[model samples]
Target: AATEAALKDVGPIDLLVNNAACTKLQPFLEVTADQFDLLFNVNVKAVLHVSQMVAGGMKTRGSGGSIVNVSSQASQRALRDHTVYCSTKGALDMLTKVMALELGPHQIRVNSVNPTVVMTKMGRLGWSDPEKAQTMKSRIPLGRFAEEEDVVNSILFLLSEKSSMINGVALPVDGGHLAC
Candidate 1:
């Protein structure tokens, strides 16, 4: 309800961006159910709740709108330490497709942007140590991490009319990391 109320000030929402995330890296045996629920609630449930709120207006308008969810390469490419994170994003990726199909008739487009190792502030914290950074860098086929601009361009494309017919898809902003 708070999420919806916050959007009330924005009036009608033409674009909805679901970009929340949480991660806990631990050995399979070390993970607690509580940790799992925390990530799921923040990463998944919150997205649905917000999307539904804005989507109603989009549907009623009967013209069109766009929903862009930020998923991750982890959704498809498994990292050794990312068990719960991968599962949560995988669910997000699936939700994008399901929502796309269900909302297509309303001209409400639903899609996802899946990035690999982006060098966002939070992302860099995970490998602030030079040795860890190098190790992480080696895994990216592009030989470098993703810049914010790289992701912004993809997102702008997806949000713009250029991607009018694109839906139910997970477009990779990964610089071909999955290919490597």
Candidate 2:
């Protein structure tokens, strides 16, 4: 409702960034139905809902737009204890591709950014253990986890005219983590 009201007040939207997500870190065998539901609801369903709403307006306006889904490296790589989170992100990546294919005619481009551990508040706390941090960083050729700026820059590129030709791509901002 808030999003609908905002659209009414602000008029047609040219860009939609689906960045909402949730996670529950537990062994795959230990994950419960409720936990999986919660993660999927926030990480996948919310993006689908919001994008449908925004894309409708963009379509009607015929002005085309960009949709950037903030995914994670987990979408492309398996990680222990992140089964639910990883699954949701993988779903999101596929959704991005389908949306791109379906909406391309209307000039809507959809893409996702898959970043490794970013040093945000949550990221810092999650990987604060020196041993774990080092282990993760060693995997990245750049020898460091992503900074918020790195992800932001990639998003800006995808949303800007600079990336007009780019669509349905799960671009990694992981400092070469995916390369390895």
Candidate 3:
């Protein structure tokens, strides 16, 4: 329980960021049980583990804090071959809401930041093909995929006091991709 130990060592954690994820881009039939478990273990279970560990401290300390999970637009929009990935992120989105509801009384805010295609290493592999990239961009109202800065801004906002009153929300920083 490294997560719990870390919380105990720190005495009280003011923030938690559940950013782990795994994806196997294959057709539904090709996804094995092991692949499915791997995705859920990292994307869903890890979030629960870390949040539960830190949230208790924030509650007992009586000082409010923020918990931001990095979800994906796949939670709302389907991709061609991301069945397991999408499901795990969707689960994280729901968990953020439930955690927020449970922890609100203790002044622990739980929320999520969802981003569409970004220009990271992973995004390059997923969108480097010009035709595919264009098709993907077409679905976004902003007419472009997200940049790293776009996702960072969303996370920073959730962490800052500026979002103090905002809780249990899933903010999509997807360049309007979900709007389509």
Best by TM-score: 2
Residue 39, model 2: lDDT of 95
Per-model C-alpha RMSD: 1.3, 1.2, 1.5
Q: Candidate 3, which segments miss by more than 4 Å at Cα?
A: 5-11
In terms of lDDT, which candidate is strongest? 2
Better of 1 and 2 by TM-score: 2
lDDT of 2 by residue, 1-180 (tens): 876666677767898788887777899899999999999999998899889988998898899999999999999999888999999999999999999999999999999999999988878877888998899899999999999999999999999999999999999999999999
Q: Count steric clashes of candidate 1.
A: 0
Candidate 2: lDDT over CA atoms? 0.92
Candidate 1 stretches greater than 4 Å from native:
none
lDDT of 3 by residue, 49-81 (tens): 888878877877889799999999899888888
Give the alpha carbon lDDT tens digit for every residue of 3-113 in model 1: 867888988888988988878777777888999999899988998899998888898888689999989888998877678888989999999999999999999999999
Q: Each model's TM-score, in the order given?
A: 0.94, 0.96, 0.93
Q: By the TM-score metric, which is better: model 2 or model 3?
A: 2
Model 2, position 94: C-alpha lDDT score: 99
